[model samples]
Target: MAAGAPRIFVSHLAGVAVFDPNGDQVARVRDLVVMLRVGRRPPRLLGLVAEVATRRRIFLPMTRVTGIQSGQVLTTGVLNVRRFEQRPTERLVFGELLDRRVTLTETGEEVTVLDLSVQQLPARRDWEIDRVFVRKGRGGAFRRSKGETLTVEWSAVTGFSLEEHGQGAENLLATFEQLRPADLANVLHHLSAKRRAEVAAALDDDRLADVLEELPEDDQIEILGKLAEERAADVLEAMDPDDAADLLGELPEQDKERLLSLMKPADAADMRRLMAYEEHTAGGLMTTEPIVLRPDATVADALARIRNPDLSPAHAAQIYVCRPPDETPTGKYLGTVHFQRLLRDPPYTLVGSIIDDDLQPLAPDAALPVVAGFFATYDMVAAPVVDESGSLLGAVTVDDVLDHMLPDDWRETEYDLDGTDDGTDGTADDRRDGTADEGTDERADDGTDGEVRADGA
Candidate 1:
């Protein structure tokens, strides 16, 4: 290590605490951001992506970093609470660069990037990539094992870029991983068909499911059509049944059946139920995975589930209690316990003792309008879905209900040339009204032929 030139591997910085000068912890390093440059120049280190208590990520500029030691980062106490937004030139180091393959020009060997070591450039405030830790050649499996490791100057390796600068698909896939699923789907939507399929093929099942759920029906079908039968089934299995069923509903009957046959029996059965309901109905909007407890479950159990960071806001609002056959929701539906009630009760109190029987659950067959009215009248964010047998089936969240109520073509619409989006929407015939002829020629309702006069004229 060069004296007075402090350096830390990016991997070591993951989750390192960020503290103010007074030693009060503020946040943890979620990721490192960098700016890729042209002509083999090392990407300049931008700053840290700090994750706050709310799990929201914010940018911490490099200038604020006072020290990096004792498994923690010290900041200048100055901070910005705004959420981090990526600039076009910025890339997240861990998400976009680490674990990707790069080639060593001298040995013509490919290696996986394990971590990057960065240090401030001499006589300058700027921090730059100094070296990289790479794992070299095991070459037996899809994910290469770490055989021998070495640290090399950043310039000795290649294949890191934000844009298409003759980089390979692996590099592009790395950048894609950094995008949120919706944004990633938009990128896929614009790609050449062949390239889109290539990118789709590169993603794992869960990632593919997330992206597929965000895409339009046409794009969803196109991507699924290009995937192998088994892979497509896997992707569907990873999706929420409602989303999977909706996508499957768009396929031809034979294709849908074949794909379903390839899926796990339980998942396929759930999809069947979801597909049977009208798309805008309560049954269709509900998810089968809401947290469930039996009557004997204690308040402690409910609080634990609610405390789970992964629970969605609506799902965390209450805990459902049902009768036996609990593995699946095939038992008698008892009632639910709201989160606030859990906090009020003793930890050992049985959930059944304080069940909110006054909270009416939704019937699976309830119409969309009825579901909307139920939520509005009761001020509920989520309602349990029960079947005619009085068995717990699922819980319909307000988000799903509201989403189903949106215009079918909402995702397809775009802002107009004047930066305004609302209008008499254009139709398939490229006319505001479907009855108009498809011609670009402008006509006017003037007394004279061939022109529309200005309002004043």
Candidate 2:
């Protein structure tokens, strides 16, 4: 940037609250609009895309912006409530700029765009990109230089510099890669169909699986169908088995079989085992990756396993004590020890000594209400699922149970965008499975062995 050029980071300007001179808050800036220019000239600032109440996004022309400062954007005129649509020549600073690959003028080596600082002109009528923050340039197999950083004027770079048909689309995906799966999924859900598919295609299998699990069943199927068959199978294997099975159940029998055939033999076996349960059964809602251990395991061993950061809160609450340790069919399901027991018992105490058998383990075919009632009756967070052969199968987590307890079309409900429920009741489906928990895909948790059970009941 030119010496002492008044500059504000592009990130600072984004999401700033815009107000009128009369002091009435208008909308928040969702992104900055810029128009690409010919060789050597920087992309010119167009306007601001702001989102207001009532869930509408409108355009605020830069000319109307009276003042720009940290945390506040003052406008001299009215904001047109017209939806902001991207023109052929325009690009978004956040959506299209940040995280893009740009070639440094000094090094001629491609570096990653981390952040940009925009400077208002001396005339105060125009704004231009000023300083850029870059990391080590691109090298081997998507690997970037570590601890490498550079700050330079916007004039020092080139990339996403042209107004082409598909300019910045891939950069958009790169920008999203920094977000958590749930956050990325939220962005994907709001995007246009073509854009969503493009972004989905760019994500790796595990990440796509994570995002897909957070999406509604219909959206999951739609996105999966767009992927190559082998890729789709890989993604399914990456997802939690129960979630993968839930999605496969929605597909046609032929389509389901085709995808299953493409999966690894072990993964396919697990999928088939999970798919065997009815959607509302306790077995249907359980995740097979529960913490299972031999009866001889010590509390210290149990504690170490739960310490794994990736274990969802529900799964870590209890330990299933079995005769043999293969969790695939947790052999001879002896009993369960709640997390609280591990904390209370001595480190060297055998898990078998603390097994809590107060609550009954659910059969694979237990109906939804039975599972829900089991949770409510025992006030539990998770319960073990065992087969008729007395082999430990999996644990029914509270989150999965609660999701099933909600209406089948819960995602379509008019609650908050962040997925918070608004206390409104929803319509129910038919498929009664004995208890009232009928057609819902809810799951549940139940019983422990000791008095101070991990209480993930």
Candidate 3:
């Protein structure tokens, strides 16, 4: 939904038809999934539980939902047919929250929740429960009684947030909700195995995928091993193709094949293609998904594609201009159009006309050192990898190159806020002591100091 999209009442969404971009009805909304925060803060709208034509209830992540209008929901058409399984941290708005009695913070009066209003946060894709519709005088949601009805902000009521105690994984997740995936992975690394698994299971697939990419190999394998095979496949599918391939390569052949068989055919094919290459080579390190554009695509089109919030900085730094068939393993690789050039050129300019084909692209078999040299010599954040037929395979970003260059234990190494090595094993005690006096400094730097200590403490 857009920033100024009208707020939607949960009651109005119940049983609403869900359509794909083509306007075909695929499912109906059964309930809304939300994650309640630590305090009086608004609960985030996670997604919807939708029942498909086959009567199977599936999870439709809010990210996949393009719009909610005219009493119907529209999706990006990328539906995951897997059954909806509520995580420990997730709450069902219709099934769990509505009709519950909660205390109004100001009046100390108990009101039964009739509905909740969700609004998209300005300039962000996230939606939150911003208002609550309730009735007073001890009336139930269905019961007809003479009670005053009012709408109030989510923060005006109590009892919606998770309790501070006994919500192990849920509370832990809420506390570190704002932490970056890498920082959260670091916290998960120091946790006990059982606790780690609990937290990992509670996380949604997209969140878990991002965190798994940041975790060490052993940790990644361990966490993936604990999830149900179907969910493991889903998480893998959510991950970047290169990262997914790297993780699958670590698994036993049979296990790897099983998960691959479970994934979408196209994603699995990308995984197989990536896994076929040497682990440290350009093909292995490159992500199959890149900003690819046809020769005739305009600068405006390139800018819009790169503006996707999902793209990494490196991936968005430039666009690979190709012949027809823009999806990677794209037709004859034309050239590149750097973002700066796009900005300097008129919106109507064709990317092909301003192409920079001076630098040679990397071959799939290019070794790690060769890939590193390409990035260093050209000062490029990302470089294209093309096959013998001159078709663009994928693009390798500098971060993937750095990940290969660094020691295996690089992620486990402790560092101070100033980027200096702390010279201590990254243990709970070490982390707690490191932040004893420097918590403020760490917070100012990354806003994760208190969260880090909270996890370790």
Candidate 4:
């Protein structure tokens, strides 16, 4: 058992009805939720949610629950769980902690909260929370607030329940709904390659696409390498077609063809056409998902078209200004204005004038280095990709490039090769000179011994 955790059987609490301070019966113990942590897995409690029949299912922070004997939790008092509401920022399992303060080491001008330490206290027969104590970097002595204490206000303490001592891929899998894809991607970066693959395999296709979009190109390739071809293809298909096309383009030529073949015909055709252009220029980085309106369409019609469920945000960056169907192949790019810009302007205002001529557009054959540099030069989150005819092709986003180039591990490496008896170091001679060490393999290169010879007779 963990030093501080108590193991109580669930059978004890099954029949007991829970009550508030007023003695009104709430919900009965329906189930016990226990994650295997360290030693002796103890069962934890998960209260039911509030509904019309149950009225309100309030949370009981672990702190207020004084003891867990038999199966029932012994409370400090008959207080209604409702009285103590969970702060929005509080972590689950851990109690409410919002503005709690802690002293942390001040290396230079910056300050940080020290992480919690897990250790056993022999005298108390329980675990002690050893927090890191820190202050300003200046030496000597500093002014004290109530005589120098490293304590944090109880309010700032959020969830600290280590579901398990070891890393939990399943926990991460279960909490998929609670985190952003970018945060999941960041967490995945810390895991081993195999562990990361497991996490990827566990997610649904839509979620996998989201997480993939957040990962760097190298990490994307690595995770994809570990997955079954069918699974990988399914996830790619779930992604925005243009995003999928961009990622597929980054794959090795052989992999690119294999994956493309596995994709649906429509998706495959879109990717194939996108692949035909140079990668760095507008052709290579542009997304084919764009919302274009026929020049003759009314603003109401355009708004109606935009409301269609089939169109995604990626395809509908406001509306792409285009010429009528009868117009020549070259046509014209009247102007590109955002949805907000159009909505705010007078209804009669032509989109051409409203469109920002300062719009950044790139050619398909343009080099990627140049394109990347242009994104930096312009500080643009998105840039348009176009063909020689000035028709819109696709758009590239800064997130895609970030996922391409960001580093995985950010910690500094510590290496020390001090003393050794290996031949690489001269210390081997000193250790062997005085006496032969038992079990040492002392053998000559030519033979075990020069004196040992065979006679032919």
* lDDT measured at residue 123 in model 2 versus the true structure, 0 to 100: 46
**Worst lDDT window (10 residues) for model 1?**
427-436
Estimate the TM-score of every prediction.
0.59, 0.67, 0.58, 0.48
- Candidates by TM-score, descending order: 2, 1, 3, 4
Most TM-score-accurate candidate? 2
- Give the per-residue lDDT of model 1 (tens digit) for 1-457: 2235777787778667888867777777777878776666777776788765444455676756777888898876755544556665567775557655788867889877777899987766567888988888643212446489899988888877623211123434553456667667765665546656767776878888988987878889999999999999999999877789889988999999999999999999998988888888888888877888999999998898888864568989998888887744659888889988998999999999999887778988899999999999998998999888888888999878876887775554442333422222231111111121233221111122211111111
For candidate 3, the TM-score is: 0.58
Compared with the true structure, what per-residue lDDT tens digits does model 2 show for residues 1-457?
A: 2334567777666557887766777567767877666666666676777765434455566666677865798876454443455665567787667656678777688777767777777744666676888777453212335748888877888776633222224445544455656556655665656556666776778888989987878789889999899999999999989999999999999999999999999889888999888988999999888898898889999999999986777889998998875666777998889998899999999999899977779999999999999998898999999999999888898888888989886643433443433222331111112221223221111111111101111
- lDDT agreement of model 3 with the native: 0.79
Question: Which candidate number has the best lDDT?
Answer: 3
Error of 1 at 285 (Å): 0.6
List the pairs of residues colliding in candidate 1.
Answer: 444-451, 444-452
Off by over 4 Å in 1: 1-3, 12-41, 46-96, 138-144, 158-227, 250-255, 289-356, 367-369, 376-381, 387-392, 402-457
Query: Residue 417 of model 1: what lDDT?
Result: 34
lDDT: the better of candidates 1 and 2? 1
Per-residue error at 6 for model 4, in Å? 11
Model 3 lowest lDDT segment of ten: 436-445
Give the true-structure RMSD of model 1. 13.4
- Measured by C-alpha RMSD in angstroms, how accurate is candidate 2? 14.3
Question: For candidate 3, what is the total of clashing residue pairs?
Answer: 0
